[model samples]
Target: MIEFSNISKSYGSVQAVEHINLKVEKGELFGLIGPDGAGKTTLIRMLTTLLLADEGNVLFSGKDVVKDYLYVRNNVGYMPGTFSLYQDLSVEENLNFFATAFGTTVKANYHLIEPIYVQLEPFKKRRAGALSGGMKQKLALCCALIHKPEILVLDEPTTGVDAVSRKEFWEMLQGLKAEGLTIFVSTPYMDEATMCDRIALIQDGHILDTDTPTGIVAKFNYTLLALTGKYKQETIELLRSMEQVKNAFPFGDSIHITLRNGYSVKEIEGLLQKNSVAYEKLEPAKPVIEDCFMDLMTSH
Candidate 1:
């Protein structure tokens, strides 16, 4: 339902996004996965008609976004990365305001937001700023859906929310997707990439890879190993120093390492023992999205 063709944007000398060619099919939940400052917001703004690109074109349902911005705005529901609702207004008032601005009423499209608004009904009279992070997210989403747009575009909707709230938000999105709404969401969380039907890993204003989560992980060409040791920093440094190790980086409480050709886990174990590295575990590990992303980032 959305397409970006050779899209490029910049702010002064720093490029926000460059030559980005992407497509989001109708009714598909597509994710743009990357870290902060990876240009996800810039691309979303251009797609939502809030910002213009420096070069190339964006199309919504085959209509040029630049030439038919009004249609794009009317059909696309956008929830910005930051909470952009009025802090002083009551939840009901805020929802009504956005609904009226879109030439609609809350009553007219209550069905579209009922599932989410039901959770916010008790606090409908409260000021928006007083709501918890999760509640504020629900309110913003309600406003975004108040107009009953065809496509929902969320920019880092779970950035600062708690883990449970984040999980709830994704569940709500799944419910929305089941309603056949085309969802294009961006997130910095690597684990969230697995929740999407497909994802594009982006960095440094470029797309590293675009595929299903499994497909992306399958692209990892090296044998990976995970080890937990008392000397976490020393273990990582030691692995990086070895010729048989391609790369080593700390992941959570363990260090994830990729081995070079002909290098075996036994060899690594022998080295750790030889160096008197007090490691409790050393075993082959499955490659994850982050690993694939890191590999792609390094290779690119």
Candidate 2:
């Protein structure tokens, strides 16, 4: 439903995005996964017709985003990263306002947003700013879906919400996807990437890898060791100093170490013992999206 061909964007000397070629098929839930300043917002803005690219074309449903911007705007539902609703407006008022602005009525498209709006029904008269973070999130989503657009573009929708709310938000998205809504969502959370049908791992304004969650993990071609014990900081420093160690960084309570070819796990253990760097567990670790992302980032 969306395609970015050789897309590049810049602000002065800094390139926010570069040579980004991506495709989000119709009815597919595509994720743009990256950390802050990785250009996810810039890319989304360009796709949503809110910003123009420095080079290349952005097409939405086969229409040029530059020339056919009006159509794109009407056909795409956008929920920006921040809470952009009017603070003084009541929850129902916000939804009605958006629906009216789009030349539609709340009742006309109620079915499209019913699942999400139902959760906010009890607070229909509550002022938007007075609502909790999770409640505000639901209100924004309802407003976005008020028009029943062809695609939904969410930019870091779960950034500041609580864990339970984040989980609920993804569940809502899955329900939307099941209803055949083409969804293009960006997030800084690696765990959220797994929920998408496919994802593009981006960093430093460049795409590192784009694949299904499992596909991306399968491409991690290295021996990963998870080491957990005392002197965690010392163990990381020691691992980085070794010529055979390609990358070593903290992962949760353990330190994930990737080694170069010809480096054995036993050799690492022996070296740690030789240096008296005590460790309780040091074993091969399974690769995850974050691990793959870090590897791609450091390798570049």
lDDT of all predictions, in order shown?
A: 0.92, 0.93
Candidate 1: where is the Cα deviation over 4 Å?
Answer: none
Candidate 1 on 1-300: residue-level lDDT in tens?
A: 999999999999999999999999998899999999999999999999999999999998788989999999988899999999999999999999999999999999999999999999999999999999999999999999999888899999999999999999999999999999999999999999988999999998899988988999887889999997665577778899999998888888888888887989999999988998887889899999988887788768
Kindly report which residue pairs in candidate 1 clash with one another: none
Q: Ten-residue segment with the worst summed lDDT in candidate 1?
A: 228-237
lDDT per residue as tens, model 2, 1-300: 899999999999999999999999999999999999999999999989999999999999999999999999899999999999999999989998999999999999999889898899999999999999999999999999999999999999999999999999999999999999999999999989889999999998899999999999999989999998755677788899998899999988889999888889999998988998887899999989998998899999
Q: After superposition, how far is residue 198 of candidate 1 from its true place, in Å?
A: 0.7
Q: What TM-score would you give candidate 1 relative to the actual structure?
A: 0.96
Best by lDDT: 2
Query: Compared to the true structure, candidate 2 yields what TM-score?
Result: 0.97
Question: In order, what is each prediction's RMSD in angstroms?
Answer: 1.3, 1.1
